[model samples]
Target: MLGQPAQLLEREPYISFLSSSALVIKQWLLFDPMPESDARFLLVDLRQRLPVVSMNDGASFHIADGEPAVASDPAYDGSQPTLIPGQLVPTPVWDDRAGSCNWDAKAVLEVTLADCPPVSDERVRAAMELYVTSQYDFLPRSLYLAMLTVLDGLATGSKRADRIAKWIDEKVSEAEEFNDQSLLDGLRGLKNGSHAAGIRALVKRAVLYLGGSEQEAARQANTVKRLYRVRSQLSHQSDTVELDLARATQLTRLVLNAVVSNPALLNDDAGEEASLAGGRERRTQWIAEAEVAIRRAKPDCAAVEKAIRRPLIMGKNGLLIAHLADRTQWAIDDGGARPVSDEMASEWAALDESFGERL
Candidate 1:
């Protein structure tokens, strides 16, 4: 038993390496254009024993311990997928199935270490990690949202700004000189002045710049936009949409592969693109700077508190909207400004005969 434990410890690194390589291969099967099926197979652990396969041609070949295999049968139909053996993976979290060993030698050769994006790039590495983690079947909706979050981080820019710049440029270039001042005056009322593209536009542009055709890029962008609505509903209203796991996962995989193939897609000369490494810090800095500016121009704490206490708006049902000390808006009724529901507000309003006068 002592010798067996020592031997297993010695082979642990080899087993780990194979499992890591299998993750890369699984990504290939998922996104490669020529792979007929992305179905996965079982890689049973043989403990300290080397796994060897005996072919029907009376030849045998040693396989990686983490290499997936299936029971040899003429009637094997690629169902009954299994997890990477020798690990304690939850089987229910995986949808992969066992597939045939009829390997496509050419496809295998097509993918190499060189084709893989360098792990040195933080964004590429992070995106790849997200891609791998997304394979878990735990809460598909959450995973889909998480995929979009990564995409949002990867695709930087303001959609509103892109449209405004395009429209302004087109109007100026194609104008008959008289409309120039009119356009300039019209621009003064613009809500967004920054030239950064929005999340949707950035996503589309990234896909297009990273080798996707115009149509494919547009489709991807549209899909993101639609899903973003679902994200908003889930976030703000606590609502969820029925998600097609395969389609959702495929889109994320395609976007992830594109980003991984070219990390430069995350770069922009204008510095509008958030740096993948210190992006959170940069965002925090911006918020801090904004707060400093607000503080510089604001009154004392007492005055601020007074202003917050004053109602900003009042509803017909006698619900007064005011900012709380923490800057959150709350509905204030007869119960005096607690975090209560609208129904409770209506109830409070109905109780008071002179509520209209108070409002």
Candidate 2:
């Protein structure tokens, strides 16, 4: 008579017979609160067929035929069977539900393939700043400044040629110290000294004709080598070496003035016409080549802009604010017409608002 309720067990021949036999014998009690002994005894007989059962009170029982029966933990019912002690069971998490689970398999796979990290706002800002600053710094400031000065001189038709010639002679004399022995020997044979020295003498003659000193003319002659050396170093070296900002500035002034005063020495009208003609045919080809050169110059504004845009939360806003201030200066400098103080201030204010800060 000791068995689980007929309704409690799944339809089976053994369970039906047991339930009917128990009911006829009156040994299966219909107790509201079954005692522990009754529960155990019923579980034992029921274990002969079905090995597990779920009770009405949310409890569970496990019966081993010809052995002892066991009750389950209160927290877990026989609705789900588990491995017995000493048995290896693979516990699987079922995720057949119609929605994404706690761990999305597809998402994890995609992340692995892409190898992308979660981008932080700070990092994004920093990267942006770097790009902007690099663009600014890469511009050829010295070259541009020199060009502007040259253009100015050309416009004014200044009589600074003599001065420039003297400067060149001075630079040439200095450069002689680094000249190759063969060149020096050749100059020396000219007047038993150095090519630089001979060149200086020739320059002096030119200067004399111009009512200037031979010493001044010689100085101009020396300049060609010196200026060439400086330019070479500037173009090739990573380290600044002997050249500094002041030296570069001075050189810029000298070159622009010289070129402007003596345009015939640098430009060939026919050559320029030919180049322009070629460019007209190719359209963007020449422009693309020029862009490459421009980028190589490493201008300053881009670098500054990049610095202003860097991410570190504490200083990011400050950098952006500073850029706004800089933009005001830029506008004033570049405006078609001279900008009044009020206009500059208004521009500054606009930039500040755009960047969400005051410079």
Candidate 3:
């Protein structure tokens, strides 16, 4: 089989049958004899997650080594695999002894990672890195943290409140000179409004900086308010919120990309890198290429899309990898989605009891 022209059969059926959703042989040599060759791949949803055993029966495949004098590539050495192809003879029914296999499931990795733009801003790049790193665990707190970190980084370091107090001071001074009690009382709102630093105010500032209209800014600001409350409950009270992670993740990505486009928003001397780096250091010990790699992570699409420039090889301890699809980031062009709701919290992915422990 090795010498004959590579077979032209459906790659997905066999691959899927062998690889269930739970298993991944990261950095493994696929029955390879050339120990020095460096090549690796991502086999997504291949099989259910399985333990690292000496052998995974489903993943085994056979190829005829031209030298029939001995079985397998004699030049290399490895453990003997169970159930070699075309050599079985025992079965409950004499008519069939080939063992059993179903070839119906179809799944394939179609990579289409677009070229990453030149990331000029330090803060934006840091946020994107955090956002990508959060994907592998597929957790909501990570997504929430990603959004919070990016916003904290890009939020206008300048007072979130417009310098309305100055304008108000001038108006009050003028009214007092004329003894106008009406004007003085009306301008009292300036004291509280000027001090607003909550999510609504911050989100409005970010949206406006991104050139969004007042209505758009208000809409986003409201979303920020609600989501921030959800974030607070999870962080402080250990409460759960019914959130649609897919939609929420898309929204978070949009906010981060907007920050990347407008890096000047966080021109303060101390960038967000300190807190961000410290946060990553505290979490799970490992990071995956699929998590931090720059590419579109669309809603309902768990895979990370990226360009495969060269053969990627990882050691026994390496990041889990995935494939890219479509040229654009998912949902970037697809307009905004519905915000989290009571029904969505239970129906979609939500914070389970263990989420509080992560805090």
Q: For model 2, what is the alpha-carbon lDDT of residue 129? A: 27
Per-model TM-score on C-alpha atoms? 0.36, 0.17, 0.34
Q: Positional deviation of 116 in candidate 2, in angstroms? A: 62
Which segments of model 3 are wrong by more than 4 Å?
1-116, 157-202, 205-212, 267-359
lDDT per residue for candidate 2 within 53-74, as digits (tens), equals: 1111111223322443232322
Off by over 4 Å in 2: 1-211, 244-359
Order the candidates by lDDT, highest first: 1, 3, 2
Candidate 1 — number of clashing residue pairs? 9
Q: Rank the candidates by TM-score, best first.
A: 1, 3, 2
Candidate number with the higher lDDT (1 or 2): 1
Question: Could you tell me the lDDT of residue 146 within candidate 3?
Answer: 66
Candidate 1 per-residue lDDT, tens place, 70-120, comes to: 333322222332222322322232333333334442332233211333334
In terms of lDDT, the poorest run of 10 residues in model 3 is 45-54
Over the full model, what C-alpha lDDT does candidate 3 score relative to the true structure?
A: 0.37
